[model samples]
Target: MSNPNSNFPLTLKQCRVIREIMKKGTEKEASSSLNLSQSSVSRALSQAEQALQVDIFTRGWSGAEPTSAGEVVISSCNSILQAISDTERQLQSNVTTLLKLKTYVEWRHLLIIEAVVKVGSASVAAQTLGMTQPAVSKTLKEIENMVQQPLFSRARRGLIPQTAAKQLASLFLRISPVAQSLQQSLQSLPNELTGRLSVGMLSFSCQDIVPIAFASIFKQHSGIRLQAMQGPYHMLANALRQGEIDCFLGLMRKGPIHPELIELPLLPAQYALIARADHPIHNDAKTLNDLVNERWIVARHGTPIRDYFESLFHSIDNKPPIQALEMLTFASSEELVIHSDAIALLFYDDWNINKLTPRLKQIPIPLPKPECTIGITLHRERQSTIIQTFIEELKLTIIDKLKTQ
Candidate 1:
């Protein structure tokens, strides 16, 4: 295994010195601007070089110029600083850079980094890229040189990501989808569906509506790149408003939306508290308060189901369960209730009578009317041709499937 922290001592002071020298084209001016002695500026460069084991500056009577290695390191440092400034600007005014790679950080370098991290082996990444292992290794080394950090360690079978590598991988993952979307948008043919569509779906929609609707859409459109994210309604709704998700489907919230999301209501949903068929309390006539001490598993706080749960017992002296096990995935919540004594609040679609009902039984607890409002929501300006088509299909699906039910 390799050590990332070992023998790596580059500091912020050294980075400043490098940037100042690059901008000033001489150590004397860098020292003057930084309010430091020339010898201190020179020492900063020397220490950085010693740590990196590479000479980044060329010294002569004409003053110092960055060497080949120094140029790459300087570019990366500038990118890092520029990204930080952009983030601060966005925090204040919500404006961001409209272009990709204005800093010359090559996409190929990012691709190689992604492939290696995902595959965990340079050799496997090489095969996937149709390049030799040594070529991939050489590209990785160039990236390491630019960042001036060790990204990964050698393992018995593959490469293991160190802190630096993991950080880079995170950056690539965050931006890769955007890059692909941009590429598809720019290179698409006229009047054809060729772009990425990210949909945030709820558990109820995932079971039938989204799959059936998307399956039919895929049959008609070959260019629609679909990415579905399923979770609690609140999390998915937030993702839609933040632009992390393009659209949200399932139960819509009754609260007012910021940024003015356009909601397309499809149907109404009912919720019920359920437990394993063999649970000790299934045959009882107890109210929700009667099971106050029992472990209850429910959705995370932002969804309508959770909103209903809170509203149901709001009139009680102190209210419902002291603590409920919140879950994002219905599958996990179902398993938790099936094996343990935990009770789960589920939608009718979630505990379909065909499969899960054999193991789980409803607690016969009557919930309030109109427990949830089901539909699709997206930013008003974000509604596009593909998104509109998806919403229509979802509506058609609910109509067709509900009729059968």
Candidate 2:
């Protein structure tokens, strides 16, 4: 067995001594509990504190008191000792079978087992595995069939591991060492972390161009997985708040974004009035004032588009034309602009990128020349490792898009 003092090769025993001293108070009390000499305890603690490069305790006339560093060490020691005890117990029970099982299975199955140990609920394990409960059950059943023994037992709330699972857990007791070794061996690998990211984009932005760019990125970083959803800005905002999405990709002309969200500036997209080629306003609405009398198809209130459009019109005329429709989907809105006499607001870059210019004409109306604040946002509290990575990839993709533009 490797010595805890040496394996950590730094501070575990020192931390253990400090924690014991804090719990017992005074050298005599700690020495008796740890079955060590008072001098040994004192020396070990001093050596540990010195090795860790921190003072862990304050000696008082009455007893020893834990300093801030001592308290921190105590917390760490508790976790370390618990893990060590668990490891010891597991190894005493099973090690050979586990080594064989781990060699045969993929790492993902091991990850699922770890999740099961953490959650103690098969249903929750299923969700974390991104699988149905039936699928999780079937997988477990297959494992049992392969071993010819029961691995878990059904309980009132969740499933509990049986003797077979206990044996597996014992085998898994060696996981940290094996995992550490595996991780170290793979450390020099040059691959993006593999995971799915769900992003919400403004309707106009998702018009084939953006997703196509992301697909190219995925091809390059094959480890990266992508999932995208699109709707009006408000719908995306609501989804962000509810933690249903990872990031919001769009303009932010609206006043006061939610305090909970973090918005990062990307590219500058500009506004343009788009109408069907046959629409009368395409030729008539040449200036800002001319749009006052023209009927418009604006995205509903609370959307970033509506905010920017309203503000730009308000700068010229006190009243803007009422929206003929409050459509949400880009398809519906695009169709409205394509088949109707009504003029709709669009981001010029997006319209140009999507080949939408064929179906719609940019009315030469000079509005406030508001540039779309194309940015990305997500609820500040909801950032995960995968989400942050996706945001970085998105920014790179957007920058590349802007360079070509």
TM-score of each: 0.51, 0.48
Global CA lDDT of candidate 1, please? 0.67
- Number of the top-ranking candidate, with TM-score as the measure: 1
- Give me the overall lDDT of model 2: 0.62
Name the 10 consecutive residues with the lowest summed lDDT in model 2. Answer: 1-10
Give the top-scoring candidate (lDDT): 1
lDDT per residue for candidate 2 within 1-405, as digits (tens), equals 112123332343444566678788887898887777989888988777665555566543235655444544565566545554554455435433442231123333444555576677778987876767776666666555444566677788777877666655554455434333322333333456544456787756544445755676577665444557777766777777765666867666554357898787766677777888888776666677777776678777877677777887788866766645777666787788888777788665543545555777778767675567677787878777777666566666766655664
Candidate 1 runs further than 4 Å off: 1-191, 202-207, 231-238, 349-356
Question: What would the per-residue lDDT of candidate 1 be over residues 247-290, giving only the tens digit for each residue?
Answer: 87777666436657777777766687889989988776477676
Q: After superposition, how far is residue 247 of candidate 1 from its true place, in Å?
A: 0.6
Q: Local error of candidate 1 at 313, Å?
A: 2.4
Per-prediction backbone clash count: 0, 0
Model 2 RMSD in angstroms = 18.9
